[model samples]
Target: MSALARNRVGQYEVASDLSFGDLSAAVAAGWRDFRAAPLYGLFFAAIFAAAGIGLSYYFYNRGELAWLIAAAAGFPLLAPFAAAGLYEVSRRRLSGDSIGWGPVLGAVKAGDGQLPVMGVIAFVIFAFWVILAHTVFGVFLGQSGLGATPLQTLLTPAGLGMLGVGSAIGGIVALFLFAITVVSLPMLIDREVDFITAIIVSVRVVQLNTFLMLSWAVIIALLAFAAMAPAFVGLLVVLPLLGHATFHLYRRAVR
Candidate 1:
């Protein structure tokens, strides 16, 4: 590409000013854009769901304690794949290319350096949240033994109250992190933007469109829950749609 063209492309900015107009338009545009590449979305979802199912099964069978420990250890291991998918979605959307598996994989392979960096960031943030959550739970239990078994402790009235309190704290932390990195991974992969810029822009997007972004986050969480309900079988359809939709969202935000 010519320098002028390159400059023009690079100059594209992720708006910090989020209004109802911007958010509504972004959602509509994302849906419309993703609908054009439905099959590619399906393929991506299938691969992700399959991987999730296999991992879940392996960990579940290993026992609860093992599963908990494995989750911490395995999250980082899976970060690269997650980062790759995020990048692929952004790349495909930006290039106006059909979401082909080949191109997506090619992008991941090409952006190998970014994959680990983004993965580390994601893993660290996730781990920190996990630790905080567990600590909250432990403190709650210590304060109000609630005279219940380990299982019951999570289900009893007092336990549930404590759980709710802990969850709220964890939720806030997660939301903040999500908002900060929502578009960062894709931006990095698609435009060769540095991680700092990507994160800063992402946080700006969230700050500008707080309500809309929160709504989007809720939708994603619900969808993810549903996907995991039927032994994670639903993820085959949910993951790709969500991934593609995210790319579409990024495109709308920055334009």
Candidate 2:
């Protein structure tokens, strides 16, 4: 929690004149925070990484591409809460307080039902994406009976069209969810506000810093893609770093 941002009545005072340099600075500050509290970062990240790896192994060995796609679409929904621990770490460090796992865990658990509220939003958005993806898959490729000849089917016109349409639709869903939740997760953690207020504040911040926020969003997506390769091992580093960086961005962007 921010000391200067304390005593909230669920209303936010958004800041302006933020630039790309703030993003750069936030990354640097995030790195410093990570280095200072490497154990906390690693502990939280490892849990997420393990879950990702386990899911990948199960889906791959079972040849469940449909399940994989659905999981992929929904898995990112857990992302906001993955940083709850990191936010506590950053907030404690910011306050010159000594760090302890027990205290940090307590702080996260004591979120006053706000994190679960945000999680519901994340899951609902993800569920919508999965439903849309499945509908697209069924529309273009369902009657072809291409499940037996997957490699041959993707090159066909219908399959290719489905891919194009799904990509466009998925991109829009991702962008919308990103805008709504970009800073709201951290904001909820730091402020005494409802999810709606937090989400609105987050959207306003992104709207004010449109290009820079998009750049940061792209940065996050690229990192996420790279991390998913090699069995999600890279998330051990990337997720925590990005999560920590997001907390710093929240601090900078939210006054």
TM-score per prediction, in order, is 0.73, 0.87
lDDT of each: 0.61, 0.77
CA lDDT of 5 in candidate 2?
Answer: 49
Q: Poorest 10 consecutive residues of model 1 by lDDT?
A: 72-81
Instruction: Kindly list the per-residue Cα lDDT of model 2 for residues 95-175, writing each as its tens digit.
Output: 798889987666554358877777777778888887888788788887863577887887799888888988798878888
Best by TM-score: 2
Model 1 pairs whose backbones collide:
none
Quote the lDDT for 123 in model 2.
Answer: 74
Residue ranges of candidate 1 with Cα displaced over 4 Å: 1-12, 16-40, 65-83, 86-100, 109-112, 141-152
Model 2 Cα displacement at 152 (Å)? 5.4
Off by over 4 Å in 2: 1-11, 144-152
